[model samples]
Target: MTSIFDADGKQVPCTVIEAGPCVVTQVKTLEKDGYTAVQLAYDEKKEKKTTAALAGHFKKAGTTPKRRLVEFRYFEEDKQQGETLTVELFNEGDFIDVVGTSKGKGFQGVVKRHNFSGVGGQTHGQHNRLRAPGSLGASSFPSRVFKGMRMAGRTGGDRVKIQNLRVVKVYPEQNVLVVSGSVPGAKGSYVIIEK
Candidate 1:
């Protein structure tokens, strides 16, 4: 994330994103595929590493194999097959939602995972029960721990959606987009921006 100076000399926090030179690999219509959508391909990949079926698909599109292919249902862009999309699709002040996988924090405890209060005071000769999760469940009533219990486990590395972020700037020459505030994923991870 970085800060940019707006026209009024106000500093705005924003996240820089490489907003695609995506190719329209396929266009699906209602009569043919039972829906209207466009499959866009991004990031180049070696042909030798691509599967035979995918190679044929890329050949049909008259483009090289790509690393990512995402389908946007009911896209209203009026784009045709084998066309390219860039940062020009968005403008400053446009609101969008960003979707990406968050950074992985690995295994975590209840105190860090669920904002649990560490077993209160340490007066009654308690040695190391400060961060314990107190109880599992009712002992005699249910006889088992309840489902969906908030306990210590994995943290982060989840698909996170950050909504309604304004487009602060667009550098179409460099295929970069600067959106207001921070976004999910690591520095080089790919993210989807939806209007």
Candidate 2:
């Protein structure tokens, strides 16, 4: 993440994303695959690290092994196999949606996960009950706990889609895109950008 100065001389927080130099690995047709989608591959992977089956798949596309492969449906443009896609596909001021896995915050309590104000002031025998999830449910009324109760559990590490992030800048030569505001996922994680 970085900050950029806008035309109004205001500092804007932004995330730098390597948009792509993605290769069209496969083109699925409605007749052949029962669906229409374009499979794009990005980030080069070593030949030894790639499986034999995947190696054959890349061979068919006339490209080397790639680390990430994503299929985008309803692509309006007609792209053939082995065609390269660059950051030029997006322009500055355009809005795009970025999808990626959020950073994992394992085993978080309700105070952090659900934003529960833990037990309020420590008074009236409230010893060490600050961050506790106070009342779960009635003891004998419903008998058992209801489903989808907000409580302490695993958090983050989920597929997240951040939509309508304005494109602040585009570096087509380096295949980089700077978008306003923060994006999900850790550094170097792959994100699928959709227009």
- Cα RMSD of all models vs. native, in order, equals 1.1, 1.1
Q: What is the lDDT of candidate 1?
A: 0.92
Model 1, position 116, has a per-residue lDDT of: 98
Return the TM-score for each candidate structure. Answer: 0.96, 0.96
Top candidate when judged by lDDT against the true structure: 2
Q: How does each model score on lDDT?
A: 0.92, 0.95
Residue-level lDDT of model 2, residues 24-59, one tens digit each, is: 999999999999999999998999999999999999
Tell me which residue pairs clash in candidate 1: none
Residues 81-142, candidate 1, lDDT per residue (tens digit)?
Answer: 88889989999899999999999999999999999998999897988999999988789887
- Candidate 2 has its poorest 10 consecutive residues by lDDT at 117-126
Lowest lDDT sum, 10 consecutive residues, model 1, at 73-82
